[model samples]
Target: MDLRGKYGLLIDDIAEMRTTVRIQLADSGLEKCDAARNIKEAIERLSQRRYDLIVCDYNLGQGADGQQLLELVRRRQLLPLSSAFLMITGETGYEQVSTAAEYAPDDYLIKPFTSELLRSRLERILEKKEALRPLYQVLTDKVDRAKALAICDILLAAKGRYVLDILRHKGQLLLESKRNDEALALYQGVLDQRATPWAEVGKARALAATGNEEEARQHLQRALDAYPNYLAAYDSLALLLEKTDKTAAQEVVEKALKVAPSTQRQRRLGGLALENKDYPRAESAFRRATEKDRTGFFKSHDDYAGLAKSCAEQGKIDDAFAAVKDMGNHFGRSSDLLARQAAVESLVHVKAGNPLAAKAALARALALNDDQALDPTTALEIATACFATGDAETAKGIIQSVAEDHNENETVIQLAQGVFLAAGHGEEGAVFLEATRKRMIKLNNDAVAMAKAGDLDHAIAMLTEAADRLTNNCQVSVNAALAILMDVQRNGAAPEKFSRAQTYILQARRANPEHRQLADLAKFYRKLAPPGTPIIEET
Candidate 1:
């Protein structure tokens, strides 16, 4: 219960409220407390230092709020799992803050609360965090789920007070590791004991992962019917529906938006609506996302870029051009900015019957891609522009490059497909990306085969080259590390090889922390290396 050693942050727009809370926290033995006036200051503090606790007021000024700040920090990982967030809300915001279990704070306090009540809530959350520290360190710091899973089992076997919490973590770890049967069993076990909404949704996710999509959808529907405010259930159901029916997906998002609106959800709605050719809906969604913060932290070039495309699709050339111009005010000036703006502007000009302007814009976009391509998203955006400007070959070339570099990244691949879909080449994009994906798979397989055939050096060379070039591809990085480890396993491990292997393993972890095979690779490195090789420190 002692908060003397804990670093705390107090955020409130009103100066008097911040002073009151800081004094209260001091009275409660929390001396090391920093204060922020609003979301921007909070983010700056969080980035500069990690606080053990955060106390925030719900209604921050400038249309920003504590909940939105929490979501933003959590998404960007500015706030680690170890930190405890306590929201202070008045009666007006209690219902919305209370049922927002999707991204709820660790605990919340109603206004006019004493220091004792705040201290009690802090003690409880800190106690649970301490009990699960080992698991969190492994999962968050090392990205090793096997060790985390083992720790969860140990904690569960101890019959601890936080057994439910442990079980939830274990179930998620199971699903993430692709142990669908085990995950399903864990969820079912939890459901048998009590009908928790998370367990219900987890069970549905498990079922879907194991190829029981229909059954999963039914379970999700049932979960929604029972727990109407459970946002995760809505998101899970929406994702499933997206595979076979975009219309259903959009409808699900709409309902979720009705329940609780978020910047991420709005962007998702915009994407789905755009794909469905509902230009007005897309425009509305993207506009909301772009204008919601005005801080430019939550909104990306993608939002403005999306708004531009949505407007252009509706023959609102002026509105589309305005969006394209707005990008200059928001995102940083770089190759990415130039390319994205030009790309969207090309589409707008094309829609306005200005072929010369459209061609000029497309040329500038292509020039950026040729000289200094920054990110996959921008590359794909330029590809879309290429298609819009009647330059199919350049668009395909850009798509192919981005796809090869991000062969294992579904989000990037989908973004690439969106480019083609926007250009009336959905089927062709699907086919082209599929062929590229399969080809990459075959190449990786062939390298692995070569390693299995005792050609470790050649395999290492091929994989290392690919991994270095395609740095974003975690699968390639994993294989490269595996090839090196296989060599070390056969011949004695050299210090340099061990070091390089560790580097690749770490690289893969950074690229895709949620990669299903991450645990397997970590386990492999542990067994294949010297004692305390420090690949991933055990917590």
Candidate 2:
């Protein structure tokens, strides 16, 4: 527990606990300690400096809990691999969340513990981290997976105190690398030693990946029966159930939400409820999710849209309008958000029998789309509003574009079918969707053929041309940019093409700001041409 010259962060909501922890860390030889009362503050402090240790409480008021904060930090690459994180909790339910988390702290200390116990736990965690330093380095950095696995194997050969942990890490890497059979075997072996909850869940994951759904369900149920509050088991069980039974999946999520009502789980529950046409439940879930999300670092426009739609469908025009207002207040006036918000507002007005007001709202939505075409999801909202306002032609056009761009996405196709059915055009919608799918398939197939035939230039040209024709289709723009970047990478760095790639990327970003691939691509472009701004290395 010698922390001399090693900075640390102590996070806890209770002022007394924070003081106690700070004193304990200072007594343990830490140079100094920074403190945060919540996830937002913790993120700000961590952003400023890399700490040697992070002591975080499992619960931090009504906002994001310690588990969620850790997940976000790890996802954003805020904490370094060498920083030891110790999560403190009084609730036994935390074990399930920690077990299922993709990123875990170095160790956990239960609350109401003696300082001796805390020091002992920290010392043990530090020792284990020291032993696993090499494996962690390879795991965290840009290294070959095979090399990292080999390093794990070497460390495991010593039969050390961290043997089980090493096995777990190796199994996870194996699963991530698509070596499901080996991962399953390794998880089963861990169960033989002792049936830990994490091992059971891992085995179930591997089983599900291998298409052994029945066995996976059984294993997941077993884990839940053993630990009823295991959030991870609930999540896996719900996902597994969704493949066959939506009602069962919804129930599982409902059960999990009662135990740990995270914004993400609540939003998912709302989505399921919406799909089931349970307007009241969907409205409640989405409202709670929207409120929770507003307190976080990022806000989700989809949640606000969902809330407004559910409220309008339930004939709660005032609540629906309020939801739309909330979106405008929180997210400013981004065209994409504005389009969706205005569409939802129109739905409320139409439901309230105010045709004039509904028309005005729909007109605003249409103007937004005219300025910058809407993405598929936002377009769906606008189409719904148009149908409500008795503007079938405009709705049809929007739905046609949606189906054309999203033919491969079953969810979007289903959503379009629902919208068209609501508008009294089910049969025509089906025909339009089918025709659009066929055309898009042909377009995609032709470009892919050129790509496969080694006509990189032609393939890039074709995709870029399609992108111009489909400015709002994020997938097309992203794919076109990625194709060019890949070709350049394959031919060694081509600096001349970087600007072209960036243009496509920026366009795609404008169309779908939340697209996941944008982050990695931005990082790639930055490496190719380092920015003039100061660089902050990702942990």
Q: For this target, which candidate reaches the highest lDDT against the unseen true structure?
A: 1
lDDT of each residue in 1-539, candidate 1, tens digit only = 67889999999999999889898998889989999997888999999998999999998866567888898898788887878899999977775676674567888899999989988888888888888888867766645678889999999999979898888889998987889999999999888987888899999999999999999999999999998888888899999999889999999999988887777788999989999999999999999998887556677888998899899899888899999999999877988998889988988898899999999998888888884346898888888878877889988998997898888787888888878877888899899999999989998999999999998889999999988877777899999999998888899888788889888888887788778777788888888788756656433
* Residue 115 in candidate 1, Cα distance off native in Å: 2.8
Q: Which candidate number has the best TM-score?
A: 1
Q: What overall lDDT goes with each candidate model?
A: 0.87, 0.80
* Steric collisions counted per model: 0, 0
Candidate 2: where are CA atoms >4 Å away? Answer: 91-100, 138-154, 157-159, 292-294, 370-380, 383-445, 448-460, 467-539
| Residue 48 displacement (Å), model 2 | 1.8
lDDT of 2 by residue, 365-469 (tens): 988888335677788889988988888888988887777666556788888887886677889888888888788767767777777788888889989997876
**Runs in model 1 lying further than 4 Å from the true structure:** 371-373, 450-465, 478-510, 513-539
